[model samples]
Target: MFGPRRAVFLDRDGVLVVPQFREGRSFAPTTLAEFAIYPDAPSCVARLKEAGFFTVVVSNQPDVGAGRTAREIVDEMSLRLRHAMPLDAIKICCHTSQCACRKPQPGMLLEAARELKLDLKESFMVGDRGSDIEAGAAAGCRTVFIDLGYTAEPPPERPNKIVGSFREAADWILSLPQEDS
Candidate 1:
């Protein structure tokens, strides 16, 4: 029988839309007006889908608890995201860092794996921060770091690949040998 499908888990904010930072902390962007898609996101995702890979997004948004943004705002932003690039599934950690679901914890990735029956070995993560890479690595998925220049703590672990943008990451994937299937 076929095992779980390969997937590409992407990061929101700096990877998808513009990250809203306030008071030296990350904030959930408040509106569609505030959310801007990175130039290559739409096409990058399309290529991944075309490549026979399940595309998911795993994000950490602690805005409500951090008081940096509201839950409504975050929800609204998600709606906008769906309208924009759209993913097969989106898994997010709305709670604070201590929550098991938060990135750097691997709970979200674990949950996605359980719910979707994903093949961790065949999956990869493309994100902008250390947490995104760490989370993917912890879950045994290959990781790619998108260097969009967020000022978070340095990644304790190195990702399997580091690219400047989503387009580049997609290109890397497409350029790989086709034996992956």
Candidate 2:
């Protein structure tokens, strides 16, 4: 019999893709033309999947909810990402307000856990923002923060590890000891 599955929840912008930076802050690309995945992302995700971890993307694309960007464009970017990598799923929250599915709340992770039969305790969340860390921490998973040195505030909840790139994060996660069944 198999035990519960482990996962790595990745934040879309900054973690997997390059985010637009201006005035010392990070921003998601509003257009597909501006959207581009980090060169190392696909291989890093492949490494995690090879190590028996499910790779899921949990993102907050508020531009959609705010009507600044069309939902179809975001969907297209997701579809492109799926074609480029071996992701198990992508969970996006387009709400601009304080909603349950948004990060800092853990709704997306929790819902993924329930639907994917994931073992939260053994899972990990990798992101470049405070809310991502908070969400992972709240969902009972170890968090990895990719310190891009954005002008925004640091994660209020400490992450298990801090890395400079997705490659480093993947290496750190792979270095952990495996749990016995």
Candidate 3:
């Protein structure tokens, strides 16, 4: 149960990866060779960890559902990230349905709460898309958006906060009253 308020949800693609260019209807990095992490993300997560926030990755990987990517590849990507940065957990919603685990849904965050014993109110979700924000807000956590300009349309629902980069969002969090803690 997410009780005493302790957790942060993150998205992997645009928020973490630098995001290679795509023509249309596709922009995700197609290979492990292409995956890259943001420079300041590690320190940002470290700060949250120092502040008693269990950082978890809440992502939607429908590639498995549609057969564009394999489950093992995605798992490897997550593990590669684990080696690259220190995160409490990496959660993925492989289903293509309106499943609760998807970004537009709160399933992954809720699942993280169940597994990690988080406090939803104290947690935050940082991602690069509107669904990422919606999921966090629906789960009752503050949301942050890292814009990559891939989204072709406006957000149907907005997040609690928006920032140009993860470091900016991290700086904003650090400026908060709880930063020093």
Candidate 4:
């Protein structure tokens, strides 16, 4: 019998979309106009899917909870993302405070694994933030950290791999040895 399916968990901002930067900190786009998906994002997701890995997006969008952005706008952005990529699932946590589903807690990744019937040990998490790396590690997934060189936020301590762009991240994942079916 086959075990649970493997997945690639991606952080929404910086990994797939061009994040808005203010005071050297990365932030999710509040308006649709500011939300721009990376040109390579769609193709990379397609490659992962074709490789038999579920492409899932796990993101933390705290702006909505902070009242800086409306939930409707966030939902619209999510809809646009779904239209742009062939993702298996997109899980988002909009909490401003420490919550079960927030990054660095691994709740989102764990929840996705349960709902998607994925194997956490066989999955990979790609992100550009420390919280993302921490979450992936807590969930027992290998991590890829995209180093965008943000000045305000320090780089994560350790990631399974580090790269410069989403394309590179995808390439690294593709280069890994696959387990026999």
* Deviation (Å) of 103 in candidate 4: 0.4
What are the TM-scores, per candidate, against the unseen true structure? 0.86, 0.96, 0.89, 0.97
Decide which is better by lDDT, 2 or 4. Answer: 2
For residue 39, give model 4's deviation from the true position in Å.
0.5
Runs off by more than 4 Å, candidate 3? 1-3, 23-26, 179-181
> Which run of 10 residues does model 3 get worst, by summed lDDT?
21-30
**How far does residue 141 in candidate 1 sit from its true spot (Å)?**
0.4
Relative to the true structure, candidate 3 has a C-alpha RMSD (angstroms) of 2.7
Give the per-residue lDDT of model 2 (tens digit) for 1-181.
1655999999999999999998776899999999999999999999998888999999999999999999999999999999989999999999999999999899999999999999999999999999999999999999999999877665446789998999999999999997643
lDDT by residue for model 3 over 1-181, one digit each (tens)?
2236577788888777666666532255657787778787788878877767788988888878888878888888889888877799999888977876777889899988988877788778888877888888899988887766655656536676778888887777666665322
lDDT of 2 at 80: 92
Q: Which segments of model 2 are wrong by more than 4 Å?
A: none
lDDT for each residue of candidate 1 in 59-124, tens digit (9 for 90 to 100): 887766777767777777777677777477888787865777798778878887888787888888
- Which 10 consecutive residues of model 2 have the lowest summed lDDT? 149-158
Q: How close is candidate 1 to the true structure, as a TM-score?
A: 0.86
lDDT of 4 by residue, 102-126 (tens): 9989999998899888889999999
lDDT, each prediction: 0.77, 0.93, 0.78, 0.92
Clashing pairs in 1: none
Model 1's alpha-carbon lDDT is 0.77
